[model samples]
Target: MHRLYVEEITETDGLIRLSGQNAHYLTNVLRQREGDNVLLFDSSGQVFDATITDAGAKEVVLKLTLQYRPKEEQSVAIVLCQGLIKGTKMDYVVEKATECGVSEIIPFYSTRCQFTETRKLARWNKIAIEASRQSQRVTVPVIKAPVSFSDLLSMIKNQTDSRSYIFYEKGGTSLKSQVLPDDIKTIYTIVGSEGGFSPQEISEAEATGVTALYLGSRVLRSETASLASVLLLQFMFGDMVYS
Candidate 1:
């Protein structure tokens, strides 16, 4: 069965209208007809069992038969702060990070960043939405606009009750070796762009109480580091382990 994301699904047992691209997707792309059944989800953490009551060129109507909230969401408060890596690579990182249950994704520009101009967030949000839907998560990770290295540091200084971890390519303590502070509610993981963080930048990050975490011996690409760190953190401190 096809799964669709709708903006607003208000009623548990009433007609819900899907217009514009959604309607085109159903009538033209999926070729769904009346009597077809599909799953519908909304940003409100609600899922609906819907049947196609009517299909037309402009819109489609679904009669929602059942509506229920999903299971409790992943409890981790990991925020992935990545250095801008340009184009599609950044998109891939956002998708993977969302699937891994990151609460937010921040792509910042550092000294070695390929480009500094912030990209529009429409595409990234779509990727997160699809990723969240596929991963069976009710909420999508918040994709933040790109910020400068200094700006990010300032943001770090302002964050109260949160621990910041900057993944340095140079020697630093491994992520697994550090224990999460019991008092903090959020964890920020910062990974560099293609050229990686410069020495002075790393020093400044550490001077401001950010822990420099090194991931083993091999030098991973920027995208790889961002995605891998999220999974590792999720497993160690997040909701990956059911037991």
Candidate 2:
């Protein structure tokens, strides 16, 4: 079923009035008509089966017929703390991570970060939503604004229950050998930029209880490392649900 993320919806009200871009997309782009059934996902992670009750020139109305509530433990939260690299690498990470079911993406600035601008959250969020829609995910991943390395460590230090790993290009424990924390469902992965994190940055993250892990012998580019970390963690914990 075709799915859309709708903002205004209620359990009591069965009809969803879609206007603006939504109406235009469904009517003109998707060529949806009245009686066409589509799936709707709300911000609260609620899934609803809806039919196009009206696909008028002014608006598109959907009548929700069924609601599916996800299991309380159905999700395994995976947070990606990525160093901002130059070019479109960060954009690729956000889009691919969202497609792979990353719960949140934290774009941070390390000493070697090449991209220092922090004004791309809106664009990244748009990519995340589009990726979620393409992946048939009910919830879109949250893209957080960029923060300094210290600030990133503060956040990571607070996540005592999360399985935290920072991928180091140099010597570090192999990811395949480390045992994932069994008590927690939250996994946090950190990847450095093009030049990678400095020795001090790695030590700071390590002080916050982040395990320095290696992705094998081959060194990966910044974008590839970020995507690979998310894929590996999600594959071990959450991606199977989406698959």
lDDT of each: 0.85, 0.82
Estimate, for each residue in 1-243, the C-alpha lDDT of model 1 and write its tens digit.
788877667664488888899999888988899999988887777888899999988979899887776867655489999998877898899888888899888879988997887656889989998898788777677888888988888998899878888988777998778787677778899999999999999999988889998888899999999988888888888888756
Question: Which stretches of candidate 1 lie above 4 Å from their native place?
Answer: 11-13
- Clashing residue pairs, candidate 2? none
User: Each candidate: RMSD to true structure?
Assistant: 2.0, 2.3
Give the total clashing residue pairs for model 1. Answer: 0
Candidate number achieving the greatest lDDT relative to the actual structure: 1
How well does candidate 1 score on lDDT at residue 199? 94
